[model samples]
Structure formats: structure tokens, C-alpha cells
Target: MTDRRGLLIILSSPSGAGKSTLSKRLLEWDPSLRFSVSATTRAPRPGEVDGKDYHFMAEEQFKHDVIEGQMLEHAHVFGNFYGSPMAPVQAAIEAGRDVLFDIDWQGAQQISNSVLRDFVLSVFVLPPSIAELRRRLESRGQDSAEVIAKRMQKSWDEISHWDGYDYVLVNDDLDQSFEKLRTIVTAERLRRAQQPGLLDHVRNLQKEFEEISA
Candidate 1:
């Protein structure tokens, strides 16, 4: 098959929704998909590697990059700033390698509305129920009760923007949701606009037909 332009696969969800898990599964399913390493002013959590997990930066540096228009999309979340760097994403897509983003609603909105909007595919994941969302958050054991409470409070705000995404999935079953996600990606990759090389193939076919007719 001829190569196609890469996609900016934006996956967003409220905290404790299955976006992160789905993103991980997606990358595992297709190793060619590059994960967009977002820059964040927040300190790295235990076992998180710099540049790999996130491009952890000081608040000053983060603001400087944003001012310089180096960030593709940025948002303030949890009292910290986070954004995707434009350079790597541009390079990856130009090379026909899809880039996966695990960001929040604000970031996804910005990217989807950007000049590169044509290449964007945004998906929003919703928890099956409020209780399940809270349970998932608590099961992680990564945050305190107060933090969980704050996330719960904010989840509704995130869910309200679900309609902005191209696809929305209630992540009640991990396997089923993943299959749907995979199908969406696979189909989007075959869209006519994505496959520039198809034109060349069509032209060649036309040439062959013309010679046969002659």
C-alpha cells in the first residue's frame, strides 16, 4: 500500500477515564504510532522519566516556550501548564507516522482547531458511570482523597465538552472500546485525503487504459 499522511490522534477524557489506558494500548497495537511527549510545568511523579514521560520544565521556561509559539497546544490544568511541542509532531507527521496525544479537552480543542486541523482525529472517552470513574481514580492510589474530590468535581466540566470530539466512547468494556478505537484509526487512515499516492496510482491506470484503447 502507498504511504499516507500521518494523523494527529487526540484522545481526551476527564481524569480517571480510560484515555490514558487506551492510548497505551493503541501504541502497543501499532508501534509505528509516535506518542506526543507533552511539555509540562508540573514536577515529574515517581518513576517518570524526563523527555520520555513528559518534557518537564520550569514554569518560567514553559511560559517562554508558549510565548515563542513553540507549543502546538497548551492549557493550565491542576495549577500547572502543559502543552505539545510543535516541532516533533510536525516532523513525525510529515514522515507519515501518526502521533498520539493523551491530553485534556482544552488541549484537544486547540489542536483540532489549529491549521493542521485536517489531519486531526479527536476521540473523547467517557466513564460508564460516575461511581465507576471515582472507583478507577481511587484504585490508582496515586492521589490523595482531596485530589480525587477535585477531579470528581471537574469531571463533569470535562464531560460537558464531549460533543466537541469526532468520536465518543463510553469505556465500560476495555476490550470493546479498544477494538472500536482501532477500527476508527484504521478507517481514518484510508480516507482519500490521507492517501496522496492514490492519485499517482489512478494516473498510471489511466495511462495503461489509454494505451490499450489506442
Candidate 2:
């Protein structure tokens, strides 16, 4: 079997954008793809598992890991510190199992510029329009009006970093956006598989063919 390195797939978007929904669908589409479980200083909500949902830690411990360089990517958002642990991502990549990250632009930037930058494939999702974004956020019925207003104010900050990503998708339609996302992952996996070892594999094949002809 040909050996191939795994991808650190990142999806970033504003609060009302469909990145999280798309990420969930992508995981369902490919069971082998591991979701990069992030470590957070926030307290877990009901029914949220510790390691499975997130690696819950104290603020001191989280900062210690960041200082020790144990976090692949870390960021402060909405008063909580979130980070991706380096060990699991590195291990998964070494074993050629793709890891998916549904993080914000800050975390994405950190990962994109890391030593593992070569393994990163970052994509940003954009809302079709500000009106549509507001509508979606309001429809969620989750956050209060003030919080929604704040998110809208910060939306442009996230959208402005769209150019930093390898691919940008306007998620007007969830199914279409998901199809494109799937295609991007499939192509990246194929590309990663065609490493320098492929040359050797081809040369061996040619040698075998010549031996049979002789």
C-alpha cells in the first residue's frame, strides 16, 4: 500500500455562516476523518462529554499548555480560551487519518502558519449576504438581540480573512456548499497520496513489466 500523510482540514466562518453544519455533514460523509477536539476553558454544558465534546481545562492549565507549545492552535473567543491539542493531531497525521477543525479565523491562522503548515488545507465559508446572515442568526432563537448585534458587528472581521484560505465558499445553499467541500477534500487526499514515493512505485512497476517482456 502507498503511504500518505494526512491533512489538517480547517473550516472557518462567521457565527451565522454554515461552517459548523457543513463540518457535521463532512464528518458523517467520512467516518475515518477525525474531528479535532479542541480544549476550552469554558465550563461544559449539559450532555457534553469531557474528551469527546471538548477537552475542558482550567484557565491556568490551558495557558500552561499554550506556553509549553502543546497546542497546535489556540485562540480567545467570547471570553473563553479554546485550543487544539498538538499530540492527537500529530499522531493522527502520522497515521494518515485526516483531522477536521471547525475553528475561527484566529485558530486557523495559527495552524496555517505552524510547522505543519504544509499539511494544512484551510477553507473559509462566507454568507451570501449580510441580510441573510442576520435572518439566519435571528432564526436560531438562541442568543439575545444584543449578542446577535455584537456577532453581526464582528462578522466582517471574520469575512475579511477570506483571502487567507486556500478555498472560499459562499454557503447560500447547504447541499451545494457541502458538495464543493467534499470535492475539495477528495482532491486534497488524492494529491497527498501522490508523494515522492510514487515515483519509486512507478519505477518498480516499469521494471516488473520489462522483466516479464524479457
- Which one wins on lDDT? 1
Per-residue lDDT tens digits of candidate 2, residues 170-212? 9999999999999999899878342535778799999999999
> What overall lDDT, based on C-alpha atoms, would model 2 receive against the true structure?
0.91
Which tens-of-lDDT digit does each residue in 1-214 have in candidate 1? 3368899999999998898889989999999999999899998999999999899999998899888878889988879998999889988888888999988788899999887899999999999999999999999999999999999998999999999999999999999999999999999999887887899999999999999999
Give each model's whole-structure lDDT.
0.92, 0.91
TM-scores for every candidate against the unseen true structure:
0.89, 0.88
lDDT of 2 at 11: 96
Model 1, runs deviating above 4 Å: 41-48, 57-69, 77-80
